[model samples]
Target chain A: AQKVTQAQTEISVVEKEDVTLDCVYETRDTTYYLFWYKQPPSGELVFLIRRNSFDEQNEISGRYSWNFQKSTSSFNFTITASQVVDSAVYFCALSQWGAQKLVFGQGTRLTINP
Target chain B: EAGVTQFPSHSVIEKGQTVTLRCDPISGHDNLYWYRRVMGKEIKFLLHFVKESKQDESGMPNNRFLAERTGGTYSTLKVQPAELEDSGVYFCASSQVGVSSYEQYFGPGTRLTVT
Candidate 1:
């Protein structure tokens, strides 16, 4: 069984500030995929990023970045200069290779104050 | 391309009542999935279908939930004798292929409120 853990329940940050959400996953499979999704107030989930087990390289997309570490089984997401619109519930998910199921963490609610 | 769409954005029903939620996947999508999120809980997988055939349903909570996809098109999920614990937002997603990564598109979800 694959399990994802997100320790941060809620986080607050002022506009233009940076915030990092921590996520740890446990899986016996040697190869798996990691994903990040954001659910805004509208209740629609927006796909953020996807990383496979073989790729440990950190990724950056404009203000959004992700750090993937296989040793720690941690995949962290960071928002640099986050704006008010970035306030949403972020979830970290894991899926094994060739598996259609996605195991999601509890999610972390990020609130950006203007 | 239009994204996946779900019917009856919200449904309110009493216990033991039967409610059916509909999902129309993206045009040409071969894989469709059903997931639900209970209040204060993470979204959980209910089932997966490759066209009209059910590929996996291990995540289904009970037999009260019946899902079907006819003619390899749209799908329907019917809950019989709905319980209070069944109240939550049910989401439908579609992907072109099961092996494709990060290609699943989700619908707005149908909010089921069991009274």
Candidate 2:
């Protein structure tokens, strides 16, 4: 069975503070994909990032960065200078290669106070 | 380009009642997907459709649920005699034929409340 775990059920921080949401996954397949999605209060899920198991290079886009460490089976997301707009429920998901469906973790609700 | 779209932004029904949710995917996209997020739980895949054909329905909860994507344009999910435990947010997503699953564009979900 494939599983994705988001350890933080909720996190709150003042505006401009940095916050990291941790995700850990377990899968038997050697080739799989990990994803992060943000669902704002408006009720739409916005795709954040996608990282395959083969790629361990950390990625940075603007104030958002992701760390993927195969050694620990972890994919962590960090938001630098988080703003009120960043408040939302974030989800970590996993899927094996050629699999049609995603297995998601219990989402983490984030609150950013201005 | 238009993104995926789902109808009935919110729905409330009593137990044993029936409800149907609709979704319209992006133009020309051949892959459509259905997912659900129960309260306080994770979002999970309900099914997948390639055009009008059912590609996968392994995650479907039970027989009371039926999905149809006629003409390969839009899709509908019907729940009959919905139980209280069936209430949750139903999401629809779509991606191009050659695109990877990572590119599935999601629609604003339909929130279902069973009383």
After superposition, candidate 2 runs with Cα above 4 Å error: none
User: For candidate 1, what is the interface RMSD?
Assistant: 1.5
- Model 2 reaches what TM-score against the true structure? 0.97
Least accurate stretch of 10 residues (summed lDDT) in model 1 chain A?
A41-50
Q: After superposition, how far is residue A3 of candidate 1 from its true place, in Å?
A: 0.5
RMSD of each: 1.1, 1.0
Identify the runs in model 1 with alpha carbons over 4 angstroms from their true place.
B98-102
Which ten-residue region of model 2 chain B has the weakest summed lDDT?
B96-105
TM-score of 1: 0.97
Give the per-residue lDDT of model 1 (tens digit) for A7-94.
9999999999999999999999999999999989877677888898999999999999999999999999999999999999999999
Position A84, candidate 1: lDDT: 98
lDDT tens readout by residue for model 2, B29-64:
889999999998899999999999999999999999
What lDDT score belongs to each candidate, Candidate 1 first?
0.92, 0.92
Task: State iRMS for model 2.
Answer: 1.2
